[model samples]
Target: MELILKTPIGLEKIAADRLIEMDREISLSVKPHGLEGLIVVERCSDKQALVNYILKNVPEVESLVNVEVETEANLKSIVDAARKVSRGKISEKESFAVRTVRRGRHDFKSIDVNVAAGAAVQEETGAYVNLDHPDKIVQIEIIHDRAGISVTNGFRWKKMSPDKKPALNFFNKISIVQMPYLGSLEGAKEVGARIGRAVQAYEVRELVIAPNKPVDAYELNKFIDGVIEGIESRFRIQCKSYDRKVEKVRVSVQDLYQLVRDRSGEPMIVFEPEGIQLIEAATKLRKIFEEADRVNYLFGSREGIPKGVYRVASMVIDLAPGITLPTELAAPTALASTYTVISMIEQNIEDN
Candidate 1:
């Protein structure tokens, strides 16, 4: 399960650092999915303490939106419910019928009932139906001989993953830095240094800098280099730095496919065989992040995903115009510095 942390207006680096430190103090672990996006933190335990911890620590939080929780029972129920809801038949009754499906935990909340009214009647159809998309959803509750029905006029839930949404729409005006050679750590230090310098120079603290490969033996190296060289080479600040080991490694599409027998189980790709090389280049980003051993920490997006409710400080950078990412992918902000790089400082919600 994941919790989202949202900071729509903006935040600073110290604020972000404080939030992250506070999250740890609250016993919450956060993951950074992207900049200018929500920070997603995993709920390690099934107990409600995770939510309580976040609510207790995060003060500027707006709301906590639990995207979805996948458990053995939930997986089974989701599969069964989806099949049942999608395959069921919709019938016209004596003017009205309301149906409700419980989702998430029973103790927290369940899906409200969807009701339809009118004098239409269909003799061939049954009561079983699919309410995936509906115009009106009504909530009904019965207790102690008293019944409550909430009539929500129009509310639509988004059931698709963030990747499935139109990328351009979701990432509008955001600058993306794509490092296709993230498979190794050779140049990670340089890349991290440049990225940090760019971010700091640009005055934006939040950033999305993926290594060129899924696992960079050099990701920490590059971060260390960036922190050290960034101060002397890029900025005039004097600072000490070193690499922190990553427990897990990130993977590229090709590496992922090579490592896994079932590529279909992972995210679906639409490119043809001729575009395989391009796809490989597009998905090559390492997922290793260990905080630095210095006063300032340079977190790796490929490794250390951000936690929830924390504010991120991003330095803005513009990918050169006409520059193409590996496999012909293009950064949305390639032409301008409109996009802001982000790093999370708190845990309030998970990235959707």
Candidate 2:
């Protein structure tokens, strides 16, 4: 196979139909050999043209792999195939990794092929092995006795790799102190749940419910209950989907004024209309976020923060001047803006 097209499962037929319509000379198989979600290009008048067409025209195709070698799916054959394709493709200055995907029964497991083929490729070409962030990837697609092998530039989307301290990681360092929305029990609960999900979406260092004045006990309880429910549901999905250990967002209640007092030494940012715009504070905020042990952010609900608290805050920010955000949007907007500013800071550092 010159190229293998991957589509969402059950969309293989649509991918094939589009390919045939693009060029009558191109020959391929949909779901080749009973495999699902795969189309193999057997022959094409112009391989490059077909690849370009597939990329631009085929919306259903997820990715297209250009196969360099088609060989028997034995360990020895696989190793030989990998070594043959990788001869001068990689160098010692670059790193490569062998990724094997097996779709049928075989005596040797996928790891066995990775080890044998990786060692073989490494022995033949003096390239380094960096599985986490390889410069090149030797892809192995095995289907029972038949296997297709290819070399490709690795995907560069693993922003959370340990070697990288990505901007998103800073979310862990932020502490969001938001005043709970207090009104009808239903409205309070609904707003609380939205705020809770927003907080846990980042899994921030801490989420503080800061009430400025007396609130109805039933309303507060309902809001807290909804917050708990929101945290639980989102945390469940994160636990199942996240690769690392997911920490459920911590919930705490604090009086608005007291919280400002207690976190006086740390960097505290209050969001309010009277405060400086986010753009103006970005430079200062960058330093605070990067240096502080925990950066506290205060978002008001029904009533704005006590003007007194702004004086004690390290920096007061108006996320959006003139336009007031809805109750649920306040914290999320803060999170997104912080993420953007820090990313800009990192970019500046890199550019320098």
Looking at candidate 2, the ten consecutive residues that score lowest on lDDT are 159-168
lDDT per residue (tens digit) for residues 136-178 in model 1 = 3333322212222333323444545333433222222222233
Please give the distance, in angstroms, between residue 196's alpha carbon in candidate 2 and its true position after superposition: 1.7
lDDT of 1: 0.32
For each candidate, how many residue pairs have backbone atoms clashing (under 3 Å)? 58, 0
Candidate 1 positional error at 206, Å:
22
**What's the true lDDT of residue 305 in model 1?**
19
User: Model 1: runs farther than 4 Å from truth?
Assistant: 1-128, 141-147, 157-352
TM-score of each: 0.22, 0.88
Measured over all alpha carbons after superposition, the RMSD of each candidate to the real structure, in angstroms, is: 21.4, 2.6
The local distance difference test score of each candidate is 0.32, 0.88
Instruction: Find the 10 residues in a row with the least total lDDT in model 1.
Output: 285-294
Q: Kindly provide the TM-score of model 1 when superposed on the true structure, using C-alpha atoms.
A: 0.22
- lDDT string for model 2 (113-227, tens) is 9999999989988998999889899999987788899999977556476655654468888999988899899999999999889888888988999898888999999999989
